[model samples]
Target: MNDQPLSGLTVIDFSTLLPGPLATLMLAEAGATVIKIERPGGEDMRFFPPKSGDVGTLYAMLNRGKRCLELDLKAADARARILELTDAADIVVEQFRPGVMARLGLGADELCARNPRLIHCSITGFGQSGPRAMEAGHDLNYMALTGLLALSRGSFDAPVLPPAQFADIGGGSFPAVINILLALLQRDRTGKGSRLDIAMCDAMFTFALFAQAQLTTLGHAPKNGADLLTGASPRYRLYPAADGHLIAVGALEDKFWQALCDAVELPDLHRDDRRDSEACAAAMAERIASRTAAEWVPVLAGADCCATPLATLEDAFRDPHFLERGLFDFTADADDTPIPATIVPIDRAFRGRAGAIDPD
Candidate 1:
């Protein structure tokens, strides 16, 4: 039996940066042949900081296991070449503005008309037919527009950008992958393909489900930084240790909260009232600051509270749980150098234990 689910699939990727690339990367890891089509000087991400040799580290990491071909889409011959490639391709993933692909004569309508079975996925900030569809934006802009950024704001006036690109990966990439796979499954049954319009901003609204419920059901709009999951509850928050390291505390349930209070010897902080959240948070913060993260992590673990010390990127790559699962065990490049990578979140039985790397 074949371990790779998408072993026979071919993906024509015309995306740069994170969202689209990440979706295709997951497809590539699932055994799809991803052919990345680049422009004249390559994608903008290739010039980003932190270079590995001449290539950007981020680009190198995301584009691994994919074949690259340069094409000047503005040129007639180049556009002809894309149509030729589309004739034999199973999927086409693009991240251009609303009308850009149509102007270039490579839109879903044109391609899908040629190859009736082609799955075309377009990832954009707003959507295909919205007022802001053609507007220039990025991950932060999407989050802000979709009301996700308000939930992540600090106590101060200035909004804090999330540590990761929430919209790009969460809204854009994951949705594209899910819908593409669904489209493929549907194609199998009907022998016809469909177009996927993945709007990052539109997708982000789903992440605000709880907040939306509060507004519609209870007629209460959640305040910035004061929602249940947004630091309004003491049980679910991050505490700073004496060593300046942050320890995440997720003792949300009654039992876990009690366990954390007992373990930290702050039984008074186990409050069930929203009115007491601020005081409880302050008390917990003070208590947590009395000990180092290394000292508190084990004690919290002993109590069975869902508490843990925050791991840096370096520490996370070396974490035992991931290591035991063989998530970082990737295939080496042509130079025989191991390219570190993360595993797609899937059933362990279906995953390839080794990493996928591009040739040197």
Candidate 2:
């Protein structure tokens, strides 16, 4: 018996690229049977660079454990096939503009009418009804509009794009999964499924709460890169090591700050210098620049400071903690050689398995 939480549930996934696909990927990890409906020529992510054979590495990583089927949704036969699948599916996740699904006769209203217990989740850039609902956007665009990019800009001449897709994954996929799960629980009580209109832009407001707090409490909006958490304070910032490597010093609490100061041999930094964050940051930098990141890792550990080297992507994949947890377990890539698979954040007790299931 499959003892996972979502065992026996079926998910029909119509999301391409990152957001919806990632959400369904998590659902699949929890033991849902996800059937991914792709376009006639497959999704755009299939052609993303760094291909292991024909499939993009990103595609293979995100879409592990899901069954794939090509469907031209504009075709009448395809629409019929979708309705047939919806009848059996517990969850239906789609990422399209507001009216695109309705135009194709696969909107939540139409699909839910056929299956009352179906959780129909729509993840869009804006929302179903709004001025910018139909605007073309990507992860960067969403972050720019949401004030997140501005917060990260840090008084720079131009906004710098974040390395990760904060809006796409954080706003779209995470929220969609959370709301869908909540809707499923609600279905148990009411015996009726609901439609989820998750706006990636609207979801970003949750991340702005800290900045918003400054605006509300202090009656002064936080400028770019000028907030407690935005590298403004020396206590919570990134410092450069001697070998050009960066170390993340998250010594936020007083005890951690003291530990960091003691580890770096800069006891004066522990003092509360109210408004001179730049001076404190400069002093901290001068001290940290004395040693390489490799040298400081053990020193910071000895002091028990909340500081660590900022690892590269490859280094992070090989992290001892993640490796010990079997998070890098994999299925075969396009070349039939094993490649690391992305693991869901769910705990091991409720997780299905470490590896991805083969696409059948």
State each model's C-alpha RMSD to the native: 2.4, 2.0
lDDT of 1 at 80: 85
Candidate 1's residue-wise lDDT over 153-248, tens digit each? 776766577898889999899999999999999999999989999999987889898888888988976888777788778888889999999999
CA lDDT scores, all candidates in order = 0.84, 0.85
TM-scores of the candidates in the order shown: 0.92, 0.94
lDDT of 2 by residue, 1-360 (tens): 298999999999999999999999889888888999989988899889888777787888788778888889988699889989999999999998888888898888899999999999999999888899999999888988987778877445655568888899999999999999999899999999999999999878888889989888999768888888887788888899999999999999989988888888885743553657677788889999999999999999899889999998899888999788777664535556567776668666776643442443
Query: What is residue 25's positional error in candidate 2, in angstroms?
Result: 0.7
Q: Return the top candidate by lDDT.
A: 2
- Provide the global lDDT of candidate 1 against the true structure: 0.84
